[model samples]
Target: MTTTEIAPAPAAAPARAAHLYQLDLYRVITFALVILMHVLGATTFPQDVVSDALETPLHLTREAFFALTTFVLVFSYRSRPPRPMAFWRRRVPLVAVPYVVWSVLYWGYSLLTAEQPVGSVAAALRALGIEIANGTAWYHLYFLLVTLQVYLLFPVLMKLVRTLERRPWLVLGISGAVQIAVTCFLSYPPEGVEYSTVSRFFTTLLPYQFYSVLGAVAAVHFEAVQAWVRRHRWFVAGGLVVTLAVAETGYFVSVHNGLWPELASDAFRPYLVPWCVAAIAGLFLVGTRWAEAGRRGGRVVSWAVDRSFAIFLTHPLALALLRPLIAFVGDGVGAPWTTVVVYPATVALTLVIVEVLRRLPWSKALTGRPPLELKRAAATAAA
Candidate 1:
């Protein structure tokens, strides 16, 4: 749900500024929304219109992440450019290790939970292979795989960034148009539309290329961009509202056309591109505002940021594990109302899981973060 990206330096900050408290807030909020997306998804399991309607907007989560990740990566690269291999060497493992670990774990989990159990070890192993290859070991694992693809393309993206830097608005217009076409193919494929190795295409960098490029461009012009966004704060707010309205209306229109709720709530809708742009910009403005207000991330936000990826990895399992409890809440509380209880409980349980996992000796392998050093933590506490 996040990346190992450091925030790009702002014009007002020193070029080598190590942390952007704003980005920490941004990342933490992004991760929480991802959890909330899953929560609503689980609550609306198989599908419900109301939650589906909510999902229509929460769909911005992945695009926001892709953009933020690129912004950070490009900013860091610009600070001290790394050789392609070195960059990959340092960064890929952060995401890659977790992908492998989670894929196998979720494969086993699926076997355990399978109604039609995968009884044969060989068959199960084959399925695991397919799952990992397809980035479907679990739905969430695809993010890591897509990240790998982005990394593979990072070098090219850098070149593209430089080229776009000279023609910012023009490049954005072209890229945005391309993304809209890609979104149409993904979100509203014509009846009987098909393509080769389609599963791979479905998850390919093609879908997210626009967002990634936007991030790089933003990093390239961090100051000018921030200035522009801040200057248009009201317009950003209004645009988000209007786009969300249009998108929500589009969702119901799809439903009206007899699409299933899940299909109607598809994340890649043609209408979502503008909304995602507005939402990400809106979030950035807010993040900057928080920074302006002197709200450093502090210990609480830092702690969450450190374990955010693990929280992303573990939250779904928490939800799956809490199914019976959720069902009880749903049955007792009724439709849409159940979310009030489920979301916080899921987040609490997730952080609890993350806390336990962070203490493990191989926490980074599982969490894409450094392992907790409790003794050092205690000494620091004493200080």
Candidate 2:
């Protein structure tokens, strides 16, 4: 989720310069949430497993993590102020490089194994083109693309943020309206209309603007937000749960009644804006409390947090290779048990591989972690 390189806070603001453990905790938890959602999806068996009823809610709730990631990005950008070009110079390479590398890797894998559906080289190239265009090189890469869009607009966004810094509620209201409108468009696209690649890029970020704006608002008033979080922790928690319940119930009833069946199960709908916003707020507060509770379980959390981006990139490949094993376990075990076993096993195995990659030479370009040797080599070269 830490996609970009942030400039350090100025020396005069040492207090603000220190790392925010709550945000770190948020990153780690969001990573798990995303992984869990994907695991549940990929580990499904052919049988009557958990009902669509349960899956709908889980999917809806999990999307809050997407907002969590965006929140981290804009939050970092605001705290670590840099010129527009300087920001892009440092930030874009970290993500853009990995995106291209992973895209090529996945595409080549598909070509060599004939895994993807493409009849000819032209078809394969076309598919890759679309994938890159839409930033769908992998299921997770779409985040980086949408983030890139947000980053490109960060200057403009900051202008708005500054203009409305004194009026955060107003900012939130505007963001909520934009998010709702965008979600509605996504959930119910006009009939007989086909979206182009360029449109896809813009549409992808439209629904997420609210979260970025919210994060910007939080950044401008970090102390105030944290203080508010501490004072109203219970209220935030209740709002999160209530909104989630309402949103899930709305989906459940819609699906059951066969009303808007196509949009009923979708997470990106107007109804989820409140739920996702509340969930992000509540999670941030809860994460702050967990971080304050001391360094217990710190190593494991740190390990997971450090390798989270790598895990996101490589996990789908791990799942693909392990599908047979996953299916075997499911067939041997029962419905829910299979999900339990697959989730941890997938995470553990993926982390092990990512750890190995972390130690290898030139792995940073792929995994986003600059290994010790690479850092030393760079230092030596610079000297």
Candidate 3:
């Protein structure tokens, strides 16, 4: 008798479920920072010492959000087998729906308010090239487009990273070198060549590709990094202090030397290296320590985390509504603490609005699901 041995089935893929509490807190903090950055961008404070000091923190804030995006995306999806259809189902609507809606809304507003002639549909089509000229909208939406590309490439990227998981330091070295090379190239601003849309997309995204790939690598070796952070918390903290000081000094020197004109245009790529690394280190150090803190005072963080995404999508609208109030405070009629008061108030108001919207019937598609209502309905069905 000949006996044939059968190989056991490959182990089932890990569940995709993520801890809501942890993600929600991250979302809250990052989205709040996004809104605060936008608010700062809109306002024109006196260019004095106080304004410079206040603006420094805001400069670092949104970089934290970008780095957090990489961190969360990597961790949440690392174990799950790739499902391109499912991935697009979740991400595309979240991004494209908002993009289309906001684009039309802003376009209509511009038509109504601006002195430029409202053109025919054909003329508007022609002007599509220049639609982004004003820079009022999140010029940063290009990042979302880059993120979509990264998601599409995740499976291949993840496989490659997993193969090198045993040599994480090598992966880090390669990624860091690529990132520095890309930054150096981008910093030299191409001369005499008109940047086409395709060129522009590649130019903007090349830097972030490094982070996204590094993040996947980091995910496979997360335990190692977490341990390192815990063991070297002070070192990580010192690195952050030094990085921030250098970035601020760079900003001042650029301003003094009239390089502000060159740097004023927001190019996300170059800044990603230093600012993002600092933000990631700081966040990792904090997260590891917080996890070790045994869940005490976790609720506050959880609340912020839960409301983060909705706030990100809806806070622009909220800020538009609050613009007049912001102007009122900044106009010197209010107390010296106007900025301090208005900033927190803006976040609280946006959170309240997001919470309310998350419960509405029409809003469910946008805000994921209504947790309490769904739970009650399920209970009723069971009963």
Candidate 1 stretches greater than 4 Å from native: 1-17, 194-199, 376-383
In TM-score terms, which candidate is top?
1
Which of candidates 1 and 2 reaches a greater lDDT?
1
Badly placed stretches (over 4 Å) of model 3 are: 1-13, 16-24, 45-67, 109-117, 121-137, 193-199, 202-204, 261-272, 333-338, 368-383
Give per-candidate clash totals. 0, 0, 3
Estimate TM-scores for all models.
0.91, 0.85, 0.78
1 or 2, greater by TM-score: 1
Residue 283 displacement (Å), model 1? 0.8
RMSD of each: 3.9, 5.6, 7.3
Better-scoring candidate (lDDT), 1 or 3: 1
Per-residue lDDT tens digits for candidate 3, residues 266-328, read: 333354357567766676566555555554566666555555556665666666667777778
Q: Order the candidate numbers by lDDT, best to worst.
A: 1, 2, 3
Task: List per-prediction Cα lDDT, in the order shown.
Answer: 0.82, 0.69, 0.57
Candidate 3, residue 9: lDDT: 26
